[model samples]
Target: MWKKKTKQFMSAGSETKQTLHENLAFTAVEQYKLIRANLDFTLPADEKCPVIGITSAMRGEGKSTTAVNLSYVFAEKGSRVLLIDGDLRRPSIAKKLDIDNTHGLTDLLRGKGARIEDFQSKRRDNWYVLPSGAIPPNPSELLGSDRMANVLRQLREMFDYIIIDLPPLNLVSDAISVSPLISGMIVVIREDHTEKKELEKCLRQLQMANVRVLGCVMNGVKTGSASKYARYKYYGNSSRGTGK
Candidate 1:
C-alpha cells in the first residue's frame, strides 16, 4: 500500500552529527515537529503505541539519525519513547546517543529472559534506548525470528512509541525481515546520495513484504544560506486514514 497525495515538510542545514543538540540548524526544531506530526497519522486509533521502523534504500542516507531525532520529538512531547538500534550489522545509535551498548535487542532475542527495562538505557527523561547489543553472525535470521516478534510485542505494550533504526533495505535483508513486525516504515533518502533505481527497488521490496510505508524522508536538501546544517523532509499522505 501507497498513496498519491503525499504531504511534505522540509528544513534546511541540519547537521548529521547532532541534530539532537540545541544549537542545531535554525529550522531543526520546526523540522522535527513537522516530521512528528506527519507520523501522527499512523498511530493506532485505540492507543496502541505505534512501532515505526526507519530505514533507507541504501546506507549513509541518515535513517538512524532520523529515527533517533524522531524518538526525541516524541519524548519531548511527553510521550514515553523507546529508540531501538535495530541495525545490528552496523549499529550507530549507541555512539550517536553516547549510550551503553552492553545489552540490547540481540540479548533479548537470544532468550536472555531479562526485563525490558534492564536492557534499555534511559538517555532522557522520556527517551529510553536499546542499542544493538552485539553484532551477530546472522543478523537477518535474528531479526526475523519469533523471539524478535515477541520482543516487539512487549515493546508495543511498554511505550507510547517504539522507533526502530533498521539497516538499508537494498543493502541488507535486516530491514525487510523486520518490516512485517512494525506498524509502518519511513524511507530516508538523501538528496544526491541515494540512487533512483535503488529507491525503486527498496519500495518494491517493501511492497512485496506487505509493509505500509508511512512516508519518505528526504535528507540533505541543499539550501544556499542554510547549507551550513543538514535538514530533512518527509513526504507522505498526512490525511490518510490512521494506522495500517
Candidate 2:
C-alpha cells in the first residue's frame, strides 16, 4: 500500500510533484529534475533577466514551495541565487528553509541598518535566503517604497538570480506593487482548485499592474500508475482495471 501511494504522489500530472517531501525521500530526485528543467525552459538568459517573482492566483497553492525549490535547483547549477520571501504579510520561506527571520527585506527597507549585504543567510552550496523580517500590516506600501527598488537593483548586481516568493495576487496589492521591479512573474495554480474565473482575474491584475507573466505552473499533478521509485503492479495486471 505504501508503494502504491508513493507512485501517485510522484505522478507528473497537473501538479509539479513537489508535495512528496513529507511522505517519501526517493521522490526528491524526480522533483529536482522537474525544477531544474523548468527553470531552463522558462527563464531567459540569467544575465539578461536576473530578478523574477513566483506568485499565485490565491493562497495555499504552493507558490512559496516553488520559489524555494527553484532557488535550490538554480544554486545547484553553480549560480549564485537569492531567494527572498516577499510575502511579508504571511512569509513562509524562512520557516521552510529553517533559517532565522530576525531581519530581512522589511528591516532593510525601513533604514534599520539592514543592508542588502546583511540580510543574506548563506544556506548550503550557493543558495542564500532573505526572510521577510517582522510581518508588516502595510506590506503593499512598503514594497512600493523606493528603498525596496534600490535594494532589488543592488541584489541584481550580486546574485545570478533573485527569486521572490510573493503573496496571492487576489488577496493583496503587494505582489502587483513589487512586480515592476522584477524581470518576470510565474503564477502557480493548483489542479482542480484554481477556477477559470480566478485565473482570468489574476491575469487581469497582472495586466493592470503591467507585470509580465512568464507562464503558469500547474501544481499537484499525477502521472503514471506506478510507484514513485519503481513501477507498481496495480495497472499492469489484468485482474485490476486498466487505465483507459
Candidate 3:
C-alpha cells in the first residue's frame, strides 16, 4: 500500500532514480501518519481545511522534511496532494524530492512564465510538488502579492490538499505574508535544540500576524525508550489547548 503511494509521487526521472526515492519516501510514511494523527486530535474541529503551511521556529529544524513526508503520506492515504515550496529565499523541497526548483512558486507568482498546472512536478500516487522556482530578490513581496493568493485559490480547486513548506518565522516574513492564505500552520522544532525563549517569540510573532498555528512537530525526538512516555506527556501537556 505504502509503495503504491510512493510510486505515485516520484518526480519525472529515470526508473532507477524514481525507484530509489520512492523507497526512501515510504520508509517514513508511518512516522508521517503519526504526525497527522496527532494533528487530527489537536486542531480545531472547524479547521479541516485542506491547505496547510509547515514552518519552523528556526533553521535546520526539519520543516522541509515534515512538509515533504506529510504530503507523501497524505497522498498514500489517497488524497490528491499538491505540495508547494513556498520558501522562495532558500527553497529545499526540490532537492529533498529530487525535483527542479527552476519553475516553482516564484515563477508562477511573477507572471513571468507558465500556468500553475504547467509548473507542477508530479510524483508517485496522487502527490504533486510545485518547486520554489528562481529565488527572487524580493521574496516577501512576491509572497504577499495578489498573484500568490490567486495561485493558491486555483490550487485549492484542483487538489484535495495543499501542503506548503515555508521558511522559519524567525528568519523571514515570508511565512507571515502567506499565512492568511493557508488554513493553518505547523511549526517544526528539533527536540532539545530549540530554545524555549525563541519558541515563545515565534509564537508571539504568529499571534501578532493572527496566523493559526495548527501545531508543532518536535523533530529529532528520541523514539522508543523507558523515558519516551515521560517526554510525550511533558510535550502533550505543554502543547494542549495551544498549537504547540
Which candidate leads the pack in TM-score?
1
Better of 1 and 2 by TM-score: 1
Q: What is the lDDT of candidate 1?
A: 0.77
Candidate 2: regions farther than 4 A off: 1-35, 46-49, 115-123, 225-244
lDDT, model 2, position 194: 81
Worst 10 residues of 3 by lDDT: 229-238
Q: Which digits, one per residue and each the tens of the lDDT, describe model 2 over residues 101-132?
A: 77888877887876655544444446667889
lDDT score at residue 197, model 2, on the 0-100 scale? 89
TM per candidate comes to 0.86, 0.77, 0.78
True-vs-predicted CA distance for residue 26, candidate 3, Å: 8.4
How many times do residue backbones clash in model 1?
A: 7
Compose the digit string of candidate 1's lDDT tens values, residues 64-97: 8788778878888999899899999999876666
- The lDDT of each candidate is 0.77, 0.68, 0.70
Better of 2 and 3 by lDDT: 3
Cand. 2 Cα-lDDT: 0.68
List, residue by residue over 107-197, the lDDT tens digit for candidate 3.
Answer: 6677776665553444554777788888989888888889888888877888877899999889889999988888778888888888898
- How large an RMSD does model 1 have? 8.2
lDDT of 3 at 220: 62
